[model samples]
Target: MDANGHVQPYIINKNMGKPMADFAPELPKKNADGVPIVEPTDEQKYMFDADGWLLIPNVLSEGEVEEMREWVKRLHFDPESLPDHERTILAGPTQRLIDHPVVMGMLNEFTANPALSSQECYGFSLGTCGYWYRTAPNRRTEGLKEARAFKPHNGNGLYRLPGDVHFYNSFPGKSFCPHMRVVWELNPVKYKQGGTLLVSGSHKAVYTAPDEIQDPDSDVWTTYECEPGSLLFFAEATTHSAHPWTNEENDRIAVPTLYNQVDGGFAEALKPDEKLLESMPPLRRTLFRDRYVANNVVGADFKRLWRV
Candidate 1:
């Protein structure tokens, strides 16, 4: 209390510097040229850079797919039945995806680019992740193009000028992308089977998406027709929308994990409580631990903004 009996509100928050803990993250492997190394073939990288999306067929084995199917059912049927750690930590078979070998190369490569010259070290952060399910044919309209259709969700709108901040660092020679959405399909995705719609080559387009291309059923928008174990990857800057399930026979279940620059937006994922981390191996626990590298103290030192 002050001399006049006017009470002062306490300011409790203070900058504690970095948290004192053994924080380690899966760092990206870089080549001699300082570009992060990715496992995708030259052609695959070209496809992703040009089209903004890539589909790797049969990343999961038959047995693994079956296991995932059952797990999803168990999770959806009575989620509360599982322990808090399993539910929140995403334990059991699902944990295999924390740094799945099939997709980690590209993820590490894309997430490590620097946003600006001021940044230091290179690293990526895990963003939001969730499951999706669709069944049968729906009555809702399949394809309709409008202004709000599949616009870029992050940063200062979509299209940018030549010298503007480019997310995913889409330069001439070093063409690896920055942000990516990884989707693991548990069931076969045949043509018109209700996969996500993507406007081809929209990721790098300098102009706004046209109404014709924005249409869900537009000829420019393409859908994947791959096996159940297929792994789908697309840059967030790419124009995309959900398409209605037109197969009408089987239910389509998919799990999508979004990984982005720690500096960028869309960082919504369940925090791993002590109990959850305790139950995980050191390697897996690294995924949840916020890293502290000497060069990149600001966290934003890393790269990429999803500017259209």
Candidate 2:
């Protein structure tokens, strides 16, 4: 098997050896408007394939970080100024975060459906977006806290239908994770301050996870510290959860944007409205288009499937 040069049979052989897809050889390098694409370094790619997540430190400049924070703050504190529905969505320059250079590059390789091309569309869509803020009920815990703001869920090894968008696959020139997540930290995320949680490498596992690993004490759960403006990209196939926000003085302010293949989206309510789509360039607006099957699909039983 020429792992380096050849595409191999991937992922559906009864789990005899569900190899972890090597993510480096086929990362899509796509850029944002006026911004050059930020390709993942070799080490970063290796870490992403191995751990199912990667943190690109300071991907946004200090000034950019400050500006984004201000926008988010307005959305948070000045909710009354904006309608309820608008409060949770990106506003002003923050809307550009959907196709930010760093994020687009990763989405191209990870979630973008290779079946499609950039010439036609991004191959992925912004399924939803939201920010989370929290203040600890009491003093921040010095060690891992048992109380999780959100329970860990969704990983590759777990049982899922083949049609499930949150999937992981690999071959010679590309890897596929039809659904994924990107988190932009507006505030500093310290080691124990709590942001997001993930079970390292769980995305590629073929076996069901045991109850023990879900506990915060498992030591298998991984999180890291980074300055403001850091971007965290991860596969939805990874077992991930929200760690309790323990920073009381400030707040744990983070924006998480979910993405899925262009053919389908996960969050219908967050789908972009007509006016918003009309305002965006044709290409960028593809991120919010409705779900539809492509004109061409080979050997697929369309009628027998998706009866619902």
Candidate 3:
């Protein structure tokens, strides 16, 4: 309590320690114009409107990329000792390479950049969970023929079909779970090494042609050729598929991590378990809400302010 007699903002702990309450660090109030003073840059803003992808070149250093490649090679060659899902086994200098300050700093800078709007970074390990081509133990005559033709939809051993291929929608929607994916290519792209194939503007398409309706000669899709250390970011709305590596002798690998704009207000509505939310720091909670809260009034005010 103060001399004015107004109630102070503080919380009492059960252990009887000093009352802890975060009162400072309030976000700047929306201005009279109602437009956020800090908006995304032209290139960042274009991501949401146009192609729905951003390719960052040389995000990882050559040495770091090589270390990741070596790690993947070790994992692939030793089938009996592969790392389980979420279980990481960093060998030799690979562990240090991944945990290097530079790598950590880059990740933090990219994820926390104002252009991304306080988005949460979801990390994925390509070494553990990348899509791979697996052949059946005993190939049938039809399978061999289908493989030779390079058919995209044939359930042959050459290619493993993605579980779902639909337009962007929320979680319940088949394509929603994978809102975004970042590919960290470990190996340098060569002419015929089977890199990921993607349709440049397919993410903007409202409808996807059925498998039976696809034309063999259409140029709707093209393969993504990139160097090691390059990062390819794409939205799940895109019509994309993986090409099989004809060179079985040399393994190709990439790691991907997904992140979404925190300011979009989607994360707040889809809050995980209550326990998890409660455990998070107050600043995180406040920042998340400030960025993600859907303020209908704010939108209306923005329109009136800007006459847009």
Candidate 4:
């Protein structure tokens, strides 16, 4: 009831089992292109095509970076009410954060971006935490000290490790899906503080043993050192790994998001909401095909723009 004697609108009315749109206006179509539109510069394209990774500096603002760091600290030190999954020292945000609009928007932007073309597959990696006490000592070990000599390995399934080593290849026989990964640094990177080590052109070559391959002479293989706000985008095929974090004083925190290129017609399987699809124009609907031209079509027909 209104205070002035007039009847008040049913502000708290509940309409269970009713279409939400019947009561409210529609939401903006964030996936108009079904891919990200931000075009990668020439250098970015070259790096991505050849090496399968790109280092983007200052992708997030200082404030946003601080907020993530605070969240990491809170999760790390306090476990009274946190879930068992989030108790690890290298925990990412709760499932709530993963579903948050900010994270979802970022994922959509990266996946649907027009520049990437629809050829890429997108998926999320389970948030992980790396703790020193639970693993091996990184500094004193000979295998951990030499970063360049570190062999590549993939964390496709799950494995526990004792020390720092460069990961160059994923598990053999495990159809390692081709994808990109977003690494959000929750902690700052000082020299030798395990950040991430990457080999530039390694993604183009087949998986090789450490002893069999020589170190790249070019500036391809290098350690990534950045502030907390930095976001790293790399190819799944790229050779990379967690750099050893010798700083026993501070813990290394990061949220890694993985995406990959898929075969064409993958989106057809999603079964999206009809109302959502209705709002988009036909041009925007076709954007997905434009982005991800199938490799088979590229190799076989070569004349056709798309496969399916």
* Candidate achieving the largest lDDT: 2
Q: Put down candidate 3 lDDT per residue, 132-177, tens digits, no spaces.
A: 2222223322322112223442111112235433234321101222
TM for every model, in the order presented, reads 0.71, 0.77, 0.46, 0.47
Per-residue lDDT over 1-308 for candidate 4, one digit per residue giving the tens place of the 0 to 100 score: 32334332221112443322211111112333343323344465445445556666665677766766666556545656666645533234222223233333333333322222223222222222232221125533332223323455542211223231212223321112234466666566665456666766665454453552334333445666777656566655466655545555445666665433323221122222344334444433232232244342211232222122
Per-residue error for 302 in candidate 2, Å, reads: 18
* lDDT for model 2: 0.67
lDDT of the candidates, in the order given: 0.58, 0.67, 0.39, 0.41
Q: How do all the candidates rank in terms of lDDT, highest first? A: 2, 1, 4, 3
Model 1: clashing residue pairs?
114-303, 115-303, 158-308, 167-305, 168-178
TM-score (C-alpha) between model 2 and the true structure: 0.77
- lDDT for position 254 in model 4: 65
Pick the TM-score winner: 2
Candidate 1, residue 198: lDDT: 81
TM-score (C-alpha) between model 1 and the true structure? 0.71
Cα RMSD to the true fold for all candidates? 14.2, 7.4, 15.1, 17.5
Model 4 regions lying over 4 Å from their true place: 1-39, 83-151, 154-177, 206-221, 260-308
Candidate 3, residue 206: Cα displacement in angstroms equals 2.7
Per-residue lDDT of model 2, residues 1-308, tens digit only = 34445454343222345543332322234433555556555577678877888999887888988888887778866778875545655556677788887787777656655344343355577888877655565854443234356688878633456767666776654566766789998788888668688888888888787887668657768888888889998888899888777766666667889887766645562466556656665556667666655632223322222222
Pairs with backbone N, CA or C atoms under 3 Å apart (clashes), candidate 3: 265-292
